[model samples]
Target: MTNHFPLTAKRSLELLGLIAIFGVLYIAKDIIMPVLMAFFISIMLLPIYRFLRKKKVPESLSIILPIILVALFIALIVWFFSNQIGILVKDFPQIKSNVSQHINNLSDWISRITHYNDKEQKAFIQGKSDDLMNMGTKLAGGAALTLSGVFVFIGLLPIYIYLMLFYKDILLRFIFMWFKTDHHPKVKDAIYETESIIKSYLIGLLIQITYMTILLGGILMIIGIKHALLIGVIFAILNLIPYVGALIGNIIGVLLTLTSSQELWPVITVLGVIALVQFLDNNILMPRIVGSKVKINALFAILGVFIGGSVAGVSGMFLALPIIAVLKIIFDRTEMFKQWGVLLGDERPAKSPMGFASFRKKKPVAVKSGTEKEE
Candidate 1:
């Protein structure tokens, strides 16, 4: 007779294991995040690396050249933003006047709704402003620490990417070594699929960012919104966060519009333009460019964003979808984790007998041996 494991005990162990994994992620996120980012970047650069190799470029130069190009592209973006920000600073007086006008308008609206006099409104706002000031002071110190960490993250990223690219064969060998010879083909397939997914996803994102920035910035500039390009840049970058990102981008766009302009029409126009652009992007651009290779469900995507944010803040949120996609790839290919892949996936299942009667499809009636039967 064979001894069987109890189902409840197995499930409890699984839950505990999951909790522990999350704990480890939260603890080592600072180190883990950069490495993970580098891994993705290296994968994205594989085509370039291989192309250079085919051209007889030296091994070290192949890796170094891609890194250099990527660095320069990033530097150009930084320079653009810095220049725009400098210009924005020069218009501070106008922005300040607009802000004061908006505040007074808000005060009047609040007075009408709540029957609060100007003095009471001013006092209430003053108290809130004091609290905000205190919070800002705390955030300033935190920002300095965050800024230092960012520098370190940037410094280590290229080194990590270079090493990963350099040791690509060793990594492949190690992965192969983990599995039996018979399973080597499947492992190879999974690796290839994973690389394809990462390459398509990241490259598609780059394309999306460029177009989104141009479309949003150009439209906003046409509408006479101040600092149009800056808003576009912020939105395009933030929009990488899936469903939540687009919403946040819209909020930021509106806030920027409100701060820059004295008129309410620009804010409304910003919203309308963003909505139209988002509609086009979601309905048309995403399907064509990104494809349905990683069809993550809305529920899981939102949950992943929130969970990632809790675990490692903005970086985690940004990395969450691709990580899930990679995990789904592995899970779908592995016997033990296929159920998890199904759970994470966006595939809709056929209605079951256990489902609501209204949702279940009617069975066709058939005659078998002169007897009516449901088929």
Candidate 2:
């Protein structure tokens, strides 16, 4: 026989309180995202801060130098890309003409294959042509909006970064102080794990991005792709979104190649290069760097990316994996959260092979047979 008890009123109230908290967070997401971004960026740069301090750099200078360098690097990229974009804008009429030609060619090909009349094909393509033009306009507008936001975020970022760096110690202490005395060990362990995960993830990501940029840029240039630098930079930036990013980059490259040149070889070359880079990233770079650091499975990673994209757009997608990693770290360190941690991690909770071996050795089993009476 089994007995069961209903949840007490206090337990029900606690569950409702949690739901209320989540509802509030959902509503206040916009305000929260910027602050969360600041915190993550600060965490990523903390190692540089420590390195500078170790070299006897002043606290203020240590904090300021990394932030300044990062800001300048971002500024240079923006400036270079802005000039390239200006050229593209100036050549927009030619691009549109090229696109229209491509569309016509595609329609003609479709007509031949399907045995449709030229007039019907033309009518169908006209609708598609309008859609393409509208989409191009929207993309350009979105890019402008994104760039404007970047500048604003950059201008405000240093202040938040500095504050985090300056008060890092106080912040840690404050967080730990929330727990009771008996829980200090657990809290400290959680903090340590969180730091390890964040540091590993950020550094690994930066290295991977740089590697991809150089590899992709060289390949594009070798394939005689126009605006190779721009394409490379775009791919590298988008590649931060994990699984879907490389696919998007490849699609964009193929479309651009197809539109600009009628040469099938160039398009094939572009596709090949992207595939090779993706292979290398997945087999070599990602496994050695990111995989070791973040133990999240592909399913959770994809879910995180989608949820993050919904909440915070591309920036949210970039933040998603690290956020999940941090949460996994915290959950792993908490007794009540072990199940969540196990769900988040890729590894099974089964005992290690060595442990089983040792246990077997310690408690060896006796074999019995009809002819083994001497034993």
Candidate 3:
């Protein structure tokens, strides 16, 4: 009994330590989130950084080159969205008319289906107008805060990336120093696997974004949907965040369709198209591209997304999967945490059905126990 006491105490302490770590993560999210983002970004940019270094580019220039390219890519997306917004503004009058017509159509349907007349509906909405106004004011304030945070996050991100890149060797040495000389090989293997998985996942996502945007935007354009390209690009990017982002994308696509079209069919069409795209992405595309690389179960992925969002908003949600993957790698390599790695892993496989004929053939025959023993 005494032999087990120390082991139990150790595990209890470990649990409390883990709880403390998460608490600190939640409390210090403002700083930690940006650093984590930079870490992941640096990992993704490592190949490019190495390529440039191989060409004998200066260290600082190699680091700066990828950041500049990323910045330009972001700027291009912003320019595209700004252009789309301008088009939306130009067509606002028509949109307003269509919305008004839709509202009237809705009211007529309501009157036909229920006892609530148009006057009662108007009165009901009028009563909530002040509440809606207050909600809008709160939303605007939140938006301002979010915008400021985004700018600060963006500013810190590149500097953090550069510093991480600059100290890569030191960091590698520090990691090695944590373990004994005999364990270096295992540590190196873990690091190599972690890097490979993250690289594959990130590259897969980039390809997903490109192909999804083209497929969705092209289809919508063929079907005569306005702002089809914008919706496609927006949804494709948002869908990268997993479950929550896809829901938000659906809402945005439907709202855009509603505002732009007088007929109800386009809204339904947009919803259907988004659903089909999501199905294809999840079952066919993701398996082929990401394909058991991260090996995260659907349950943990969804929970991580929600928990991460609660802790650190959008960045947290976006970082959740890769971070979990990295953690699993570390855990699987460590003797103490291999059980946790197993718990986090996707280990299930399809089972074949039982064959009745085989079972019948293998069935035991009845015999007298004494006679069989004598024989």
Candidate 4:
């Protein structure tokens, strides 16, 4: 009476479907990445677009206005960083001198430890010069790819965003049509929750970047660190990537401090400042601002970042968490996929995980690298 073949076939199809999805993502990343980025930007701008529509603004104006606002905000950030970079350029000679001194000191220390005299060191480097040249050539090609990718992203982004905004109603109708009439309520809820999660996560990230820049930069300024603002801004932006981003930020901060200053105290101070700031961010700010709406566990979050990076580089990493969150939302709302949602989410209550909506926010969960109150 029990026919196991049907069940096995169903599972096989599901596994194949997942593989095909990933294969497509990898193969068509050039187009997929830009469209995905545009989608997120559109979702983030949805509230502003809706508000303008309510005021009886023209359809085109409502969309154009929000995009312009986003452009202006980005331009402001670019302008500020340009000035900071100019300041650093003016102090370049001093920075170069300090960097050279540190490099010589490091070389000497390495030579002493490894028992490689100056002549041996020179020979070792000379022997590797050919390999280094080949590596440099490869890097140059990669750089070309990167530059072209940037232009493609800039060109396609506005177009994709406009289309997404213009066809928003059509997309909604398609979503509705994909489900039965009886599931309309669930589909609507999934859409609403997805929008809310994307909005909250993005807005929270902006807040996090702002305050991190202030606190981290301000502390470094007080400590007389050169390029304090530069280091702070770089770290703050990179910190948006989650988990591994902080580590990268830390290394960059330390590297900048070492190159800019002769004294070691500034390096120590920079590390300490970063640690304290990260603590404040992880424990205090994220929970209130982002909440726990997405609820993705740490393992998948970090894996998604790395996988996205491997697939599409920086943009992929930036888009990873939010994309995963949106997928989780859809999965959670469907009966056949709810178990996958549970695996994606944190191990918490079956009824409902405590979030900002719960009124009584639960204590932050301890993760391997740091604690995150928000998903």
Q: RMSD per prediction, one decimal?
A: 5.9, 7.6, 8.6, 5.9
- Tens digits of per-residue lDDT for model 2, 233-255: 77787888878787798787777
Best by lDDT: 1
Model 2: residues with Cα > 4 Å off, grouped in runs? 1-22, 131-151, 349-375
Q: Candidate 2: worst 10 consecutive residues by lDDT?
A: 359-368
lDDT of 1 by residue, 211-232 (tens): 9999999999998888888888
lDDT of 2: 0.78
lDDT per residue for candidate 4 within 1-375, as digits (tens), equals: 269988678778878998898899999999899999999999999989999999999999999998888878878888988998798788889889998788678779888789778787767767798889999998998898888988888778878888899999999999999989999999999899899999999988999999999999999999788889888899999999969899999999998898788778899999999999999998898888898887899999999999999989899999999999998988778766666676788765422345434422333333333343444
TM-score of each: 0.92, 0.83, 0.89, 0.88
The lDDT values for all models are 0.88, 0.78, 0.86, 0.86
List where candidate 1 sits over 4 angstroms from the true fold: 1-9, 353-375
Q: Rank the candidates by TM-score, best first.
A: 1, 3, 4, 2
Worst 10 residues of 3 by lDDT: 358-367
Cα lDDT of model 3 by residue, 1-375, tens digit: 999999799789879998997899899999999999888888889999999999999999999999998789878998999999999999999999988888889889999999999999888877798789999998998898889989999999889999999999999999999999999999999999998999889889889999889988888889999899988999999988978889998899988998999998988888888888888988898889988889887889999899899999888898899999999999888877776675677753122114234322222223233223422
The predicted structure with the larger lDDT, 2 or 3, is 3
TM-score of 4: 0.88
lDDT score for residue 126 of model 1 = 94
Give candidate 3's TM-score. Answer: 0.89
TM-score of 2: 0.83
After superposing candidate 3, which stretches have Cα over 4 Å from the reference?
1-3, 349-375
Q: Given candidate 3, what's the lDDT at residue 140?
A: 94
